[model samples]
Target: MQKKIFAYIMSVLLITLIISGIFTVQTIEKQHFSNMEEKLVSASYILSQVLSEDIQADNIEHIKAVLSKVSRELNVRITLIDRQGTVLGETSYDPSLMENHLKRPEIQKALKGSVGKEIRFSSTMKLDFMYIAQPIYRDDYIAGVIRLSTPMKEIKGLMKSINGNLLLALIPGLFLSLLLVYRISISITSPIKEIKNAAVDITLGKLDPSINITSRDEIGELAKAIDFMAASLRDKINSIRDKNTRMEAILSSVVNGIIAVDSNENILFINPIAQKMLNIDEGDIAGKHLLQVIRNNKIDNMIKGILENKSFEENEISLNYPTQKIFRLNSNAIKYPESDRIIGIIIIIQDITEIKKLEKMRSDFVANVSHELKTPLTSIKGFVETLKAGAIEDQAAAVRFLNIIEDEADRLNRLISDILSLSELENRKGKTRYEIINTADKIREIISLLQNQAVHKNIDLIVKVEADVRMLHGDPDQFKQMLINLVDNAVKYTPEGGKVQVTAYNTKNEVVIRIKDNGIGIPKEHIPRLFERFYRVDKARSRNVGGTGLGLAIVKHIIMQFQGKIDVVSEVGQGTEFILSIPRET
Candidate 1:
């Protein structure tokens, strides 16, 4: 994150440096050239004025003498051109070989009574030259022009040296500028860190905000802002603490544990439930290694993976023996610019032990019931074929065999129906029809369907529903089927005179459905396994009752399909109650 800001800064600074460098170099060059031009014209003007009279009278030798004097004195070559563009006299060039000069733009301007100059390359001298032209006037009228030409190569060489020095200046200037910017950035950030540390200390200590930084710029203003923010945070944090007392009480009332950590695999905070589970009691264990406190390697690895890579997921891993603590670690990272450093990470740990138990039991029960169902179907098919070969002609034997065959077929049909229902409920990942449903009405329908069976068993099927419940969202058929499965399971387990109650209600966060039975309660040891696909407290009795054993398993899965939570409380030989909580649509 810091690199992003650094790249942006570098780009802006580089552009500014290049633009300013070009402007500065050009300005210096232009001023130096102007000064050199003015000096050349001034010096040549003196020679033109001194030799004006002699030149108009056609004293060519005297013109050459003046030319030589100017040439030697100013390190320049002099040439005198007449009004007709012919060379009258020249200091260095052989007079016999000279050409016309009046046609030149500078020479014409000079003959017109003005100073003229041109910088060009000279073929004879083989160098870049600056020519200064001035008219030699006898009576302030037209006359020949006195022109002095000098190579500007020397000036160009001087400019090159100046450019080298400017370039050198750029290096040192840029270095200092960058250094200043870096120091300013650090100076600005340093106080922010102090304020941050103080705020953190205030939070950990549950005390007042205290920050210290001295400056008198925008950074100083920001330091003041930090001080104000810290004070505000302290007050708000206190307010939160007060409000959280009730929240803490509510969370503590729950049996599940909660653990929240930082990206560094350090235990940053924990709730009461988590504290109880971990058995930690100290002044402050906030910044300690999780592995040092948590011995469970599986959970440690999960937490590390999630915190490092933001891998939020579900898994069943043991936290302690005799008490299995399953957790769903939902985690994410926070990236903040820290001046060329890395971002931060956080992990949230939620105990899903009860939900995990339900899932596992549901799995195991399905497997067992499928085995049971296959066995009977296989036996019936084998027996029917054995009788068909030899007993077909015997009327008495055939009649008895036909009755058994019909009964077995009915059993197979019933088994198939159960399997279909279970599969439909369990396969939540598969597509299914869902719609808005009156959960209360759906409950009544399921109870009515199961009422006759309850009556046959001399069981009282009672229902309590909130009539004022608004319409809800779900697969109504699936919901009804799940309700029938749960109630049927309850009746099957209950004694003849026991009562079964189906209740539905709503809270602020969710709609709840509960099936309670005063029946042969599940043994504490077997309760955890009850929801497994074919898991049974009494395998023999479940088989005798012709149960596929997938009833509760199907119920559990259907509840989950609608994004709900379930829990069962049971006591051996007493009673069992299954509670399902479904979140309300927002």
Candidate 2:
């Protein structure tokens, strides 16, 4: 910028200097030429007066002598020409060797009775000359032409001296102009450079308010404008930053995952949920192609379709890489507010994995419930029908069949009771009665209640509790029910003469209870589904033991309500241990 300004100023100065110099030289040269023409014309008139009588007498010697002396005095050439276009006398050359002077422009003009003047190159002298010609008259008739011509070398020498002076004068002018232009350039570009740097800083997200330019010129005005613009920009940027922060907060807090892409398919933004869902790094995924981050064809194609058609689209896509999850993608084209021109796409992704699992569980639960109820009801109905068909006539047979019917009814009652208990635990929501539960007393009560069954199976039920086993805060009845279910399951699963142990203790934040048993131990793979409703390791053994296959499921629901966790460790041919860690406060 500085260089450009300097060059521009210097160019104008140089042009101005050149024009001034040319005009000055031309004026001086023209004045010199006019003065020279006057001197030649005056000299010619005096010479013509002195040579008029000689030329009328045709005295060539006298005429040539007078012309030579006058030419020597004036440093000019003198010529005499007759009316017949013959050179009669000359000072610089022999009169006979000169070209015809009558046809010369100045001579012709003089013959027509006017003072003639011309500048021409003389062929004989091989120099430029300014000529002034006057016609001499004898008795009111033109006798001859008297001409005076001065060589232009003198004028050229004077002009050369003036041009040399001009060049010498221009040297200081150019140097001074250089200095002035440099100062001007600095004055102009310095502030502009500062503004440019400030603008650069602004682009880099640095807003500096102190751009101090003190000049009062146009450049200063520009600086002021830039300062104003920077201030406005700072405010705008701050506003935008605050808005972006709020937008990010809203997006982050939303349960659904969100992604926004531009028309070019580059990712504009991905919320935290989306980043986690797609297993993408927030820093790495921005401005990246959609497929580069997600690599899900269905979502990418859905977004593309919406972008192309300027319409809303939705799809359920399953991803298996990060985790097996089902996501419902609701996408719509983001368009200009005033028109339907699509600019980008916004996709709201809902993670439906848990919802789908719950749906399937509900369906299976209904089916299992119906099957379980039908099995016992069918058997009871068959036996009653049998008894009604005349089996009552045999008293022993009737007693045996009635006993079977009663047992089946008892089993059906237990199943229904367990089912109702599980449903109640699930539907309890947050309506739980809080009370202190003594872990040791609850275990004792559960053991006494299940004592007969344990003895019948010849199984030893042992309770080992820490003296400081903290009292838990929860619904006391729910706590007792959970303890009973765990203890019963332990006793029911242990083989005859095998051992079942219930341990309760306290941790930093939880009341830990462990039920361990030595029995036909479950396989490692079945532990995950052990708490599922109606899930049995050995169905025949379970039914023979009069188990409803819902005790653990009920225990699971109770533990969930207490905001506790349960884990199982088991190996085939080895013992199984169920560890329940319930928070002490709930």
Candidate 3:
């Protein structure tokens, strides 16, 4: 801006100087020309009056004398012509070569008693001249004339001298203008350079609010304003940093899994809890697909629904890891502003494996314990009521009520005993140490104990084992109890004359024990919840057959404590197969 302003100043100065110089030269030249023409004309008249008297008398001596004197005084040339057009008198030039003056243009005009002026070129003089001739009248009659001539060549010389001086003036004026422009430019540009440096430093993030202040003009004010702006900008940046620091701390400390993604469903950020839960390798998964990195299909599906159909998603999904544990995934989606367009998805994952187990255990315990006790309690109440209503007075009614009460009580006792055994199996910390042993001998021992019951029902109870089954690590007493549960369940569920088989073998990492029985098989929907407490495909039959409803749940907890897995396969009315796969301990 300063450079441009200085350029404008220089331009205005140069134009003004050019216009003034032209007008000055023209005015002086016009005055000089007018004064010179007027002086020459007045002198010619004076010479004509003097010649009028001399020519009327033809006095050659007086004319010659008068012409010479007038020529010397005025610095002009004079000539005289007679009525016959012959050269009568002349102050300069050769007389013999002179033409007849009577018929000449100036002489004829003088003879008519008038003054005439003309510009003409003279060959002898070799220049242009302004010639004026005035008539010498005698009593308003004819007379000879006196003429004055001036060479215009001298005026050309004068103009040339003036132009030379003007040229001299032009060089110095231009030099001075340039010097002025340079010096003033520095005055304006110095402060500008400082401001420019400050702006550069500020933009590059080096300096803040420390630009130079050089003047009291508009430039100085602008510098102050910029400095103030830098200060405000610095403050805002600090505030943002503080806010971000706080947010980061909170995000890190959270226990539940949190992940934030962009509009593309790319993982922008994931908290430590989420990273650990999902088995992610990197702290930052910026460009990876949310599902690809986290390996949760539910996360991908939920985000797709929110982005495509503008719907919300929440569901429980299962996630498994090779070495650590299994997870129950509960995912949720939300639109920040429900009315506005959804920009991205935020997913929260909760480790609900333990919560699910505890919930199932609590609910099952209540239902099982109540049902087990309710049967016996209700039978006793009925007997007491019958006695109160005089049924006790009839011996047959009393005997029947007493028999029902005793049967219900016996069912209650069996339920308690099974519950105790299951509780003991679940409490591995309270159980004895484990050892590697041939569990086939112990399985055979349990088959012998339940063999009479199997024969009474005409069932074929078979025990199959590897010819040289490898020893597996386990607690003998608990192992035998596990065998008892399997054999007992098989005998109770299988029809008369059916085959019940107990098989054992050593798989690479562990020994697998399978119990297959020809019985009513389980349905597909009941397979998953079979290990849950109080869960049974046929509740009335399970209870009528003296099932405590805590057996499978207890078995599940025991297998988990031993770091093992169990599965059941069945088809309704065909048979049931229970496969227990336990890891061989070191």
Candidate 4:
């Protein structure tokens, strides 16, 4: 801006100076020519008066001598012409070689008894000249013409000198003008530069309210407007930031995952929940295509459908990549406010994996309970019918049938009790009773109670409690029940002369109890579902051993109440080990 202003001002000043100089030189040249012409006319009149007598006498030689001397002194060419249209005397040229003077414009007017002035090129001398002619008279009659001519070169030289002086005068003026223009440009552009810098700072998120411009002109007004605009922009940006922070908080706190995409299917936003649900990192995910982040076809299809239809859509999608999970996707098209133009889509994702598992468990549990109850009731009914059908008269047969019925009734009662206990555990919620339990005493009690069974089978029952085994914190009855179930299973599964071992120890943060047996081991595939209700490895053997298939399931519920984890290691015939790790505190 400074350079442009300076250049513009200099250009205008130069143009004005050039025009003024041209006109001034022309005026001075014109005045000099007028003064020179007047002088030549005066000189010619005086010379014409003096030469008239000589001309009348016809002393042409003497006239030539006199004109030559005066012409040399005046630096002019003098010519004398007769009225008969012949050159009489010439200073620089011979009179005989000169052209006729009667046809010359100045000579013609002089012959008419008046002075004449003319400027034209002289063909004989090959130079441009100014001519002034006066009539020479004798006895008040026209005798001849006396003419004086000077070359135009003298006038041109004078003009050249004038032009040179003018140029010299303009140099300092030009420099002074440049300095003034520089100061003016700085004054105007400095304020503009301040405004520009301030605008740049605003773009970089720096808002300075104290923009002190002291001028009262338009530039000052412009600066004030920009300062106000900056303040307004700062307020607007802060407001937007606060709103965005609140929106992020709300989205993070929500349980359901949320995603938003633009019309081009690029990701606009994704909450943390959505990032976790899709098993994707949240960094730099915005503006990426939806399929590039989450490769699930069901979610992509649902979003695409919402986009194309510009309406709501929903779907339940199962993901098997990161983990097996069922997600319920609810999607709807986003539109411009108060307008129907579709802009993007918003999707809400609800994880229903746990809910679906619970539903399935409830259905299976009902069927298993009915089947287990019906088996024992059918056996008892069959025995009773057999006794009624003349089996009572056969004394030995009736006694055997009644004993079998009693055993079936006992098994049924145990099954019912186990089912009720499992139901109670499942329905139990909130914190459990935290009682300090002696680990060695509990293991001993379990071993003692199950020892008879182990003896009946001729199996060895071993118990080990490490000295460092600390007291565990949990419901004492639940802890004891959990151990009994595990010990009993070990005894029941082991064949004759097989060994069962129970070891209790402590780690830094947990109480570890391990029950291992060298018995008819379970298959690797069955270990996962070993604790499920009514699950059995061998149905016939389980019934013969008076097993209800609910013991391990009950033990699992108790461990869960104590916030403990159980792991099973088994092979077809080697052995099975159940490791229970309960936290030192509830």
Candidate lDDT (C-alpha), each: 0.75, 0.86, 0.76, 0.88
Superposed model 4: Cα runs more than 4 Å off: 1-22, 43-105, 120-129, 135-153, 156-253, 281-285, 308-311, 388-395, 466-469, 505-511, 583-586
Local error of candidate 1 at residue 114 (angstroms): 99
| True-structure Cα RMSD, model 3 | 10.7
The true-versus-predicted C-alpha distance at residue 5 of model 2, in Å, is 7.0
Candidate 4 lDDT tens digits, 173-260: 8888888888988988898888888888988889875667889999899899999899899899999999999999999889999999
Q: How are the candidates ranked when ordered by TM-score, highest leading?
A: 4, 2, 3, 1
Candidate 1, residues 1-586: lDDT per residue as tens digits? 3344445666788799889878887888788888777777887788777787786677767767777877888777888777888887777777568666656778877877788888877765678888889887778576777788877887778878988998898898878877766765666567767767766776686455565666777757776786787678878888999998987687667665656566677776566766666666654666787777766688688776765566566655556653756666555555556663324444445667778777876676567556766777777777678677877788888788778777767767777777777775556464666788887778888899999999999999999998865556778877887787789889999989989998888888788888999999988888776776666789788766667666777777777778888889888788899998887665
TM-score of 3: 0.55
Across 1-586, the per-residue lDDT of candidate 2 in tens digits comes to: 8999889988998899889889999999999888998899888888778877887788889888888999899888888888887998888788788878767899999888788899899887899888899988876888889989988887899899999998998898889889989998998888888888877887887776568897898877877887888888889989999999999999899989998899989999889898888788657678889998878787778777777777686689898977899999888777789998777888899999999999999999999889888888899899899999999899999999999999999989999989898888778877888888887788788888888989998999888989878887788888888888877787877778999988988888998999899877788778889889999989888988888689889888888878899988887767888899989853
Q: Give the per-residue lDDT digits (tens) of candidate 3, residues 1-586.
A: 6678678888988898889888888887787777666776788788777676777687889888888898888777788765666667778876568876665566566677776666678654789876777776776765667777777787677887898999798999889988888788887877778778877877887547466775789989988888887788788888998998888789879887888777788877788888887788865577788877977676677677667776555656666564334454443444466565555667777777788778867786877688778877887888889888999899998888888888888878877876776666656454565676566787788899999999998999999987766565766666666667767888888889899999988888887889999988888998888877667778889877777666676667666655668878888898888888878643
Cα displacement (angstroms), candidate 1, residue 207, comes to: 33
Ranking by lDDT: 4, 2, 3, 1
TM-score of each: 0.39, 0.71, 0.55, 0.77
> Which model, 1 or 2, shows the larger lDDT?
2
Judged by whole-model lDDT over C-alpha atoms, candidate 1 comes out at 0.75
Stretch of 10 with least lDDT, candidate 2 = 305-314
Candidate 2 lDDT for residue 359: 97
